[model samples]
Target: MKIATFNVNGINGRLPRLLEWLAEAKPDAVCLQELKAPGDRFPEAAIRDAGYGAIWQGQARWNGVAILARGADPVETRRGLPGDPEDAQARYIEAAVGGVLIGGLYLPNGNPRPGPKFDYKLAWTERLLAHAAGLIEAGVPAVLAGDFNIIPTDQDVYKPERWRDDALFAPEAKAAFQRLLDQGWTDAIRALHPDAIIYTFWDYWRNAFGRDAGLRIDHLLLSPSVAGRLAKAGVDRAVRGRDKASDHAPAWLTLRKA
Candidate 1:
């Protein structure tokens, strides 16, 4: 099975680009983030025509998440993160696809330091860690995949010095991401290509893509049961350079069948 994650930026306007990628890449399962649409306007028919069944959690003009399984319908598992009942953002979704429990998430951006947004980001990650621990204890085949909005390490970004003050790469954020690894989740792409400079997102300004200035924020972290099946993984970087393309490219991994 192949699993992939992408932050579409805006699903309605980017439907064409999205469908095109779906048909071409043909990932067995895909975790999509940043729908930027309400639940009612998800374009279900268009995606259905593209040969996939999907379940999405959408918020108008902001965050959203979905799980799409090619040629098969995904069995809905959970709608939101567990720790906070008051939190209503459409940033996380979970489903069962071909025996694997897939957790798709769009973690908070948390820009502008010393602010509420940053505080929320940290709080959200703490929730993620708590829930992830449960999954690990259960020992189920699971994958936590999506636009984590986390630059895990200096090696994961273009300029460590430039982004040191950024929320995505802040010490607290990186530490949270590290805690996930410490909890026994394998960082798929990095495991496969440890020393390689791989990036999943590039800025639209300053000719970032052209200059190869990008960050590896989107990721697929696998539980031990699923990690053993990792065969190949990479980013579809060419997609990022296309017209009307999202700033993020799809990050994907293929697994050997059990």
Candidate 2:
């Protein structure tokens, strides 16, 4: 099975590009983030026409997440992450497809550090850690994939000194990411090509993409049961250079058949 994650930026505005990538990549399962649309407004017809079934949790003009399964609909598991009743954002979605539990996430960007947004980001990470531990203990084949909004190490960023104070590069966020890894989730891309500078996101300004100034924020993490099946992993960097493309390219992994 092949699994991929992409942050489309805005689904409606980028539907054409998204469909094009889907048709070309043909991943068996896809985790999508940042739909930037309300639930009722999701373009079901467009997605269906592309030969995929999807379940989305959307919020108007902001965060959203979805899971797409080629040739069939993903069975819904949960719409939002637990542990926070007051928190409401379409940033997390989980589903079951082809015997694998997939968790699609759009972690908070948390810009302008030393503020409330940054605090929320850390708290959310805590909740995610707790829930991820349960998934690990459950002993199911699972994947946690999406825009993590984290630069795991200085090596993952093009210019470490430039982004040292940014939320994505903050020590708190990186430490939280470590907590997840300590629970034993395999960072598939890093594991596959250790020491290589692979990036999935590039900003639109300053010719970041043109200059290859990018960050490796999007990720596909595998549980113990699924990590051993990993065969290949990569980033579709060409997609980020396409017309009307999202800032993020798709990060994908191939698994040996059970």
Candidate 3:
């Protein structure tokens, strides 16, 4: 099975490019983030037309997440992250596709450090950590994939010095991401190509893509049961160069059939 994670930036605006990729890539399963549309606004019919069934948790003009299974409906498992009753953001969605659990998320950007947003970001990580531990403890074959929005290491960013104080590069965020790895989730990309400078996101400003100034923020992590099945992992960098494309390209992995 092939699975992919992409932050479309905005689903409605990028629908065409999305559909094009779906057709060309033909991923068995897809985790999409940043829909930037409400639940009612999700273009379900169009997605279905492209030969995929999806389940989405959308928020107006902001965070959203969805899971798509080619030629089948994703069996809904959960919506939104747990551990915070007061907090409400369409940033996490989980489903089952072809016997594999898919956890798709759009982790908070938490820009402008030393503020409430940043605080919320850290708090949310704690919540995610708690829940992620449970998933691991459950011993299920799971793939946690999405735009984590955290620049994991100096190697993952083009210019670490330039983003020293940025939230995505914040020490706390990186540490949290590392903790997830310590929990035994395989960072598929890094594990497969340790020294390669693979980037999945490039800002439109300053000709970032043209200059190859990018960051590997989006990720796909596999649990122990699924990690051994990983046959190939890659980033569809060409997609990021398309006309009016999303700042992020799709990160994907293929699992060997049992």
What's model 1's overall lDDT?
Answer: 0.96
State candidate 1's TM-score: 0.99
Candidate that scores best on lDDT: 1
lDDT of 3 at 240: 95
> What is candidate 3's lDDT per residue for 1-258, written digit by digit as tens?
999999999999999999999999999999999999999999999999999999999999999999999999999999988988878888899999999999999899998897998998899988888888889999999999999989999999997999999999999999999999999899999989999999999999999999999999999999998899999999999999999899999999999995
* lDDT, ranked from best to worst: 1, 2, 3
Worst 10 residues of 3 by lDDT: 80-89
Candidate 3 stretches with Cα past 4 Å from truth are: none
Pairs that collide, model 2? none
**Taking the candidates one at a time, how many backbone clashes does each contain?**
0, 0, 0
What lDDT score goes with residue 168 in model 2?
A: 99
Q: Please report, in order, the local distance difference test score of every candidate based on alpha carbons.
A: 0.96, 0.95, 0.94
lDDT of 1 by residue, 46-143 (tens): 98889899999999999999999999899999999998999999999999999999999999999998699999999999999999999999999999
Greater-lDDT candidate between 1 and 3 = 1
Q: What is the TM-score of each candidate against the true structure?
A: 0.99, 0.99, 0.99
Model 1 residue 251 CA deviation (Å) reads: 0.2
Task: Report how far residue 237 has shifted in candidate 1, in Å.
Answer: 0.3
Which segments of candidate 2 are over 4 A away from where they belong? none
